[model samples]
Target chain A: MDLALLARLNEERAARRAAVLVTDLQSNTQRLVLEKDIMADPLSALLSDALRMGKSGVVESDGHKVFLTVQAPVLRIIAIGAVHISQALVPMAKQLGHDVIIVDPREAFASPERFPDVPVHAEWPDVALPRLGADRYTAYLLLTHDPKIDDPALHFALKSDAFYIGALGSRKTHGKRVERLQTIGFDEHAIKRIHAPIGLNIGAISPAEIALSILGEITAKLRLKPDGTKIGN
Target chain B: MLATDDDLLRQAEEWRREGRGVALATVVETWGSAPRPVGSHLVIDAEGTFMGSVSGGCVEGAVVTEALDVIESGAPKLLEFGVADETAWQVGLSCGGRISVYVEKVT
Candidate 1:
């Protein structure tokens, strides 16, 4: 029932770290639900459920309704090509609150002169992907048409927990590329996650259009289920 | 109440102590080009109260009715409205879109 402890718990939760709050619902008084007590307390179960689901809710404690708010951290997008499509995609993704990093071995393509505001990594994917350590929130996009540039990145993406992995190319090129991945021991499911011939089926021709389509697909994948239901489901 | 959810909750508590009724409306689902995303919230009180939006005025009237019902019953209900509904044009939204709203009594 300590308000100061509840405020501290809220601050910790806002920082994307896990913290639990217990409340006497009838009195509208709250207590910090610490990690140590999570194993034994029923309220901690609700907190864990909310954390797992990335949801906020009103929980009944004692006899009152206590609002539990959980804030999920932002996701990261690793663009493995500094092409024209990326020029448009980076800013758009940033607007949507994604942390974006552009990577390319070609110094001329991956320069601060081209992308003044965004982070550009002028190293190859082999060196960069390990440093990044892909998580569930990390999305990887291989925009370089060159297999030499994309293949290593794809290998790392396939090994990691990245939610979305897309590679830009024509259908024919993607088919050939899939064959190469198969040779490298990638199974069908792993290759399927690549989203080759990237972007939604919007028939995009211009670079900006292509970027829009890619972002649309990314948004759909991130926010909506395959059945078109919202992600909370 | 000033800003922030805590302030709003405190205000809601004070209103309850003063015998005022309040309802909460949340956007649970949207379909075929909804202007607002799911999980968006709007709150309404006894005296035609309002806060936030569900669908750019497309379903506010329907939400208001639902909110009144929630306030009366003190129970939550999930309501769906779309352009396909016969009365959708009367509410100013007939763009062939749909939304599911969850209405609950908050105070």
Candidate 2:
């Protein structure tokens, strides 16, 4: 471990960014592993493969021992509505370690007084979605209940790499939404990516409970195992 | 694993100041169905006391033995284990996956 590399690793650790030290045992050399933005590190990439194969290990590093800790990256939730569900989901998602953003054109709903301490963007989806680059770690929820707002956001989301995209509506509304998406040239596979009537069926009645179900489903999808995997019930 | 980097360095330095020998074990590589991933670590003292794990419980015995040898010889050894690997199964890692472990005495 050279002083310069050690200093860099210390800086990353202080920032609480996930990092791994890869060391060559034969040569007694080490290198730090860090991603450009939010891609999986070598440890996570290896672990993801291991989790698929049900394997784990304690690989050695240049005379020093190294441990692979699975640190889940920060979950970003982009809510394109400032409705009741948004109000409920923001606090709930924050408690679950998600960086939540509520985007809407209504100043009355998207104001700081309404959603204190949470990021609010009073702009159209075309305007707001570009600023928030969707990645594998991000989940998009369109609860605007208006085609003019939700459809554009879904269009933007479909073009990105977001792992989960959900839109709020009844089955009839979603059916119409899907037709509109098809008219816009999204294929069936791309349309399948959207989780309509978003949220798990926990028999939720209120906005808060519904928000819980949505977050629950998001967690389930995020933590889903790679190869026909199921979480411990 | 319980101790942070600063804490581990401090403890190791204190032990060295007290004239105690220390050995550090690290996971170098893993292949095909191991219990822990690469980069797992464990540290041991001259008396064969150990902290942390490389394979949960499957390969600690061999790791400790290697650590003891590293401490004695003041040299490092790369240990490999798997169900396919002959030497590792005796130490109880008979689970069919291979792991490469490096044991070295820390100055």
Candidate 3:
């Protein structure tokens, strides 16, 4: 590996951009293909599949073997409320290698004492989310259950390329929420993206169990194929 | 502290920039329930100091030993380890898996 190439790879990671490091095992030569340039590459099909699956492996390219080191952006969890479930979620999400960020306008809930060693924003979603730069790799958790905060956050999340957007609410609550979203100009297709009554059907009762279920659903979204089958299973 | 792949790659660059001879070992191939997936990285310096794992601590020792030679010579080496191979029997993957590692020096 060249020092310059390693530096460039790290640079892409810091910027949250996706890149694939292609290494020809026979020649020991290497080249990097950025996500934007994958379609132009000769091995575009293989490269795109690798990027979509976020896996790195060896592939046969024209009778020679080349290793594809897929460097996708690290996944992030932007929990919209600094509440009980969020407290439980912070450490669990971190253990799963997803960076967790908390945002709440209430200074009481969003404090260092409650969430230590985590980045907690004591500002409304409108003020905090833009700075967070939520992208396709982000999973938005609207746990506050407060429309004042979650609704504004949804506007930003729906507009962005965030992969998983889950809101904590009951079916009745979600019905009203959908009506509100419709009034705000979000169509049926866009509004359908939110996973209402969030998390898997784990029959969670306590805060910790709910947190676990939410993470379970997030993991499914991250790992499952488009047809609802597990990837690499 | 769990070190992610991002951290491992960044540390490799840091070690190389500090004038230390560094070699990177990556799991390019895996078979039969390999603990670490492909693209996992293990970085070793000249002093045998290494971080990260390619096979859940089952083969780091062997990979680091091979990496030292890779650091000495600029040439890269492809090492395959499994329970069946004679050379890999000493550090065989207990999980009954096979992994091919690509070890190369950072220039």
Candidate 4:
């Protein structure tokens, strides 16, 4: 491996970007593939799957063997509302290798002592999320049912490339939320992206159980594309 | 099996830079009862050091043996083992499953 390529790979890691180093065994030639540049690679069609799955492996291409060394950014979760559910979720997300941040304007709830292991932001989601760089690797969970808090964040979550957007609300509450979003000019498709009644249908009744369901749903949305769409055809 | 290093590629790179010959074995495919998921890796260095796992305890020894050969010969090899088969039982992978791993030098 060349020093230049090694440096480039490190650069991607530092920037928290997903990429692959494609090495052809027959020629001993290697190419660095940042996730953004996947479409331009000759093997782009075959390579994106590995990128999506966040795994590196040898691939057969036109009778030549290619080794794809995958590098994926760390997963992150931004949970709005330092409520009881978040108490359970913060640690659970951490256990699953997620860097979790709990954001709330309530000083009483968003205290360092309460969540010593995770980062606590005593700011509104709209204010906190932008500083966090909303991207494909980010998942936003609106645990607070307050419209003033969750609504502004929804504006940004819908507009950004955040992979998963989930909010806690009942069907009736979501209906009202949908009406509000429509009044604010978002189309039906954009409004539909919010996974209201957040979490999977796991019949969860407690804070911890609901947190588990939400995390499971978030993981599913991240790995399998939202709306159950397949990538690269 | 899969060891502590979550990022196997970086570990392999470090090993190579340390003057250790390294080979990476990745589970490209798996079927029924396979402990590790597809794309799991086990990187073995020339000095008989390894990190991460391809098949828990079921197939690491065989993959490590092949990985060392891949490091020496600079050749890539594809391996398949079925846990249900009698031959596979002696080697490992007796959990009644099958997996295909691709071993290659990390150049």
The numbered model that scores best in lDDT is: 3
Off by over 4 Å in 4: A1-14, A23-29, A53-60, A65-70, A223-233, B1-5, B17-19, B31-33, B72-76, B82-92
* Tens digit per residue, CA lDDT, model 1, A1-233: 12245346546534434555443333544466554456676676787776555565556666655655444445678999998999988788877767789999999999999888788999999998898676666889999999999999999999997889999999999998999999989998888888878999998999889988988888888777678898666
Residue B74 CA displacement from its true place in model 2, Å: 15
Query: First chain TM-score in every candidate?
Result: 0.81, 0.79, 0.96, 0.90
lDDT minimum window of 10 residues, candidate 2 chain A = A49-58
lDDT of 2: 0.72
Ten consecutive residues with minimal summed lDDT in candidate 4 chain A?
A224-233
List each candidate's DockQ score: 0.05, 0.14, 0.91, 0.27
Which has the greatest DockQ?
3
lDDT of 3 at A162: 94
Assess each prediction's global lDDT (C-alpha) against the native: 0.73, 0.72, 0.92, 0.81
Q: What is candidate 4's DockQ?
A: 0.27
- lDDT by residue for model 3 (A159-206), tens: 989999999999999999999999989998899889989999899998
Q: Order the numbered candidates by DockQ, best leading.
A: 3, 4, 2, 1
- What TM-score would you give candidate 4 relative to the actual structure? 0.83
**On a 0 to 100 scale, what is the lDDT of residue A70 in model 2?**
28
- Residue pairs clashing in model 1 are A25-A64, A26-A63, A26-A64
Best by TM-score: 3
Span of ten consecutive residues with least summed lDDT in model 2 chain B: B1-10
User: How much is the TM-score of the A chain of model 4?
Assistant: 0.90
